[model samples]
Target: MILAELTIFPTSEGVSVSRYVKEAVKALEETGLKCESGAMSTTIEAPDLKSIFDAVERAHEAIVKMGAKRIHIDLHVDHRLD
Candidate 1:
């Protein structure tokens, strides 16, 4: 599996982005990826890069739909054969 860590948020939305975060979470769910959300970020596991990319794309779209002109996304990936 490909393990991915994603931190997606708006840089200029406001002090709190709980609403947008929720939206992103929803988008992630819709992508059918295994995801766990933490206080500062979320971790997702996918079978391939396509699934991870789809999740990330959906997440970015969610933030943009929230009216954020500037968004910050931190993505880290770890791929293992075992």
Candidate 2:
């Protein structure tokens, strides 16, 4: 399993990005992965690396559809065989 944390945002969207962030969160949640929302980032647990990347892509696309040009993502992943 992989435990990951993702912090994504549109850099050109000004200081407050709650609206876009919420959309991304919704998209990710719809994936049915184990997830938790936090102030700075979101944490998710997935069966494999593919699952984690897929979810992040969905989140990114969600924001892009919201009129984002340049996007930034901070990701952390921990893979454990156990």
Candidate 3:
């Protein structure tokens, strides 16, 4: 499994952070990846690296589409489940 931690600072386009988070989660869900867990705080879950990457890309795109001036993303992976 993989874990992606993202920090997004979107422009003040009247779009709440929660909205971006929801869109991000929806995009991840559309990828058909298993989201074991997630949160609006700063973390998301995916079953594999590919899915995690895809999710990040989708999130970036979504923010851009929403007219975000800038966005930042950070990702972390943990392969050893022990």
RMSD of each: 0.8, 0.6, 3.1
Instruction: Kindly indicate the candidate among 1 and 2 with the higher TM-score.
Output: 2
lDDT of 2 by residue, 1-82 (tens): 8999999999999999999999999999999999999999999999999999999999999999999989999999999996
Determine the C-alpha RMSD for candidate 3 after optimal superposition of all C-alphas: 3.1
Per-residue lDDT value at 31 in model 3: 71
lDDT of 3 by residue, 1-82 (tens): 5666665546555566777666766665677665543454346567667777777788678877877776666666665475
lDDT of 3 at 74: 61
Identify the superior model by TM-score, candidate 2 or candidate 3: 2
Task: Tell me each candidate's TM-score.
Answer: 0.95, 0.97, 0.65
Provide the lDDT at 19 for model 3: 74
Off by over 4 Å in 2: none
Alpha-carbon local distance difference test for all models: 0.93, 0.97, 0.65
